[model samples]
Target: MGVFSTTSRYSLAFLVMMNLCLKAMASESDIDFSFKNFGKVEPHLALYGDAEVNNHSSSIQISGSTNFSAGRLIFRKPINLVGANPRTMVSFSTYFAFSISGENGDGLAFVVLPVEFPLNIFDGGSMGLLRDRKIKFLAVELDTYMDKTYNDVNNNHVGLDIETPVSVKVGNLSSVNLVLNNGEKLQCWIDYEASGKRIEVRVSKFGETKPVDPLLFYYPLDLSQMWGDEKNGVFVGFVSSNGNSSQKISIHSWSFKSRMPPPRWMHSEPLDPDNVVEIKGEEGIRSIPKRSDCTSRVVLALVFGAGCGVIVAFFIVFVWIVVGSKRPVAPEELAGKGNEFEYKKFGEERAIKDGDGNGEK
Candidate 1:
């Protein structure tokens, strides 16, 4: 009995240790955030500058200023840019919904920086990012206004910035012709593939599906080298700024996955049109339906209707033929001398009369 009890205790201890190790490894592999409401957010989220939680709408307003304001929201927990095994790097993807209103001056960016917690940065056109030679970071900027100093391609564009405000590459937002400060909400997707060291950014109107082509694509970025020898991880968050003309920048929803094409095990809510905010003066800018999908639907409807009509016509014709065959022959036509039935009856009566006459004789 003593031997059995000792073996059971050892087995239970081994199982507990294995469970703990598995959990730790899983947490390192992925990080997911769903900002449905502030109450549900993890305690690690640190809000800095003008950022605040709006309980009425359940969104985080990063910056709302007419003069000059800045805001930053950073996750306190550091994420490994490269996995535990140095040879394999960790890939990441993110989806977010945001809106800019009023006179849009500057813009907002999603950033991964090697800075410590409680970051206080510059405002205005800088987008609240710290500009220091020693600071290393990567940013995907959604710029709204043109800056001559940066050689901006257009007022509305997306850019990839590495270690400096000047973009290494930029893609013009040709689809958006209207002023972005019109209170229109937009959604964006960012994907980073570690193996290829490539990054892609896609944008679409809020509540619409993602576009097939990416607006910005940058390749050959060495994430491991970007982290530098001193750092093996970085903090992820958002930063926004406004200049003389300001706007209200808010994040309605956000999600992050630590793997490319996000695994099925991760749970995130799909975009819902009913939850999207209706913007005025946006009717003209609504997305048009795809030609192929519209054509297919119309063709299917016509084929189905034609098939039903043919079946109904055949049923009507069959019913008419059946009714005509059952109709009785008219009595006037049957009594005519040329009728076969009338002739047979007359012969039978004559034969019976002849028999009667012979008996009388």
Candidate 2:
């Protein structure tokens, strides 16, 4: 029964260790995908209203050349905004190539909205969103038509919107000698860093190198608060609408990638005791080591393995000394040949003597 209990305990420990390993692996849920040309049809895509695949151009027509047309092209799966730990927010970078070929229109936007966002709330000037007070979303708008209701900067500009159509920050493309509705393909990049709580946007003509400086940079925007405890996560998509029949918004290609970084301590190294400095009473100060001093996971693993090996070796030596000290000693009379007993006292050496007297050797 005791042996069975010991085996069961070992099995339980193994199972628990395996469960922890699986959870660690599962926490690394990253999303990475790229769409080149979008093919002749939408793959793993969801379209609503006037959104469709343009087989001739091998692109996604976000809004058709029709008056008051609104549409959305969303990836089917939701991207996690909050990490598995719920405290860390996921950081992401997305790039898309699009073109607007028309005389006049409202514009389109790349949006992140709740998973249960209503699909029917799309309008031309609203950029496929409604003016409801309850809806919450984040968007990067490429406006080609100025609307007074939303206080648009101009007909050719980029804006970052939080919750409402009204932008908190706007960037005029004319300053950079770029036109939004010039019927030319353009590329846009949006990056968010969870560590800095910052988001940046960049735009350039298609096939051009990415800009060194971002067109717009917003900080202190905690995206984790945007979802309001919506466990299902957020949906990422392109929203577009046209106010005139001649307006057309087409997306040539798109790609998205996201990462959920581990806790800061996981990337840190054990501090050296000798390097620790005693803090004085607000007088002298010294700079600590940089974060680059932290070792990688490989080095940490090797160190941990070495520590465990030392502990196991010490335990083996300890057991050997304990058992050896407790061994029974043979009687002096029974210490002859074939006595089947041989023991040495600790801290003493045994000397054998010859059979004759005074022949000690």
Candidate 3:
């Protein structure tokens, strides 16, 4: 809706934006632009209509026009959100945050695609307009119906299908934080409870007088909006459509960081000039490192491990002492019978008798 704040500072480490809500970001710096650092690129289609959300709430009215025609919203032209170079993309993705009530079709997708028209729509009839299309876009869908082919979290669930696969309404959402990636090949990160306000961290940057398209292109985009490297690009706006079926979806408020998570590397360390480790990939493809945001994680893990070891050792020592005490004491030599050692084995005898059940009287 409005520009994010400028006061906050974001390191190259990670893009830490404010939590999304109905409210706009305080300034431009707080809202992350995925490709801003690499180059100047603007989203061919970006909307903050009814809402703009993330892993949590994702539902909306898919239009400034014709969005309410049916129970579903559709897209005639695909919206592009580019991150890095398309050709070299090991994986590409885009996110659409919206919500759905009455399930006639599926919900939405975070797609990285190849074409423009003939966009995808729903198969199971929950997310209609934004459902199925036979194009080159990768459909990371949060499906809500049980299509015959493909996997499902339950009757209704979240799934990742390449360019409109068979009907796959995997799961439904009350408040879900779903994610799609290429590691397990495809996976959805859904959460039980919406994350409470952890910390009010922030970051931002200023805009330039120069055109912003080149920078926007650095981030990934959906196939529908992938037109090539052109100067003074065409119409740029969030696109949606509603077929015979109409559903409502919206983006609550989008707050992105310049240092957002990498495409396939969420848990890896940022590129550190001080210390860097480059791992080889399959073939000639280079692989990156794991995310090193373990500032608090490492400390917590060590503390817990040590605590458990201490508790275990204390228990073992306590048990050993108790068992040793209960063991019978050996009798010392009794010197009383004219320099002769008389056997005084009462404790030993009692222990043996008890062991043999001879002292049962």
Can you write out model 2's per-residue Cα lDDT over 113-154, one digit (the tens) per residue?
898888755543478787555778999999998888889878
Better of 1 and 2 by TM-score: 2
TM-score per candidate = 0.62, 0.68, 0.31
Please rank every candidate by lDDT, starting with the best.
2, 1, 3
Q: Say which candidate scores most in TM-score.
A: 2
User: Candidate 2: misplaced stretches above 4 Å?
Assistant: 1-28, 120-125, 265-361
lDDT on C-alpha atoms for all candidate structures:
0.74, 0.80, 0.33
- The TM-score measured for candidate 2 stands at 0.68
> Better model by lDDT, 1 or 3?
1
Clashes of each: 0, 0, 90
lDDT of 2 at 90: 83
lDDT of 1: 0.74
Off by over 4 Å in 3: 1-60, 63-87, 90-97, 119-134, 149-155, 167-247, 255-361
lDDT of 1 by residue, 154-214 (tens): 8788889988888999988776453455678888899988766789999888888888888
Q: Which ranking of candidates, highest TM-score first?
A: 2, 1, 3
Report the lDDT of model 3 for residue 162.
39
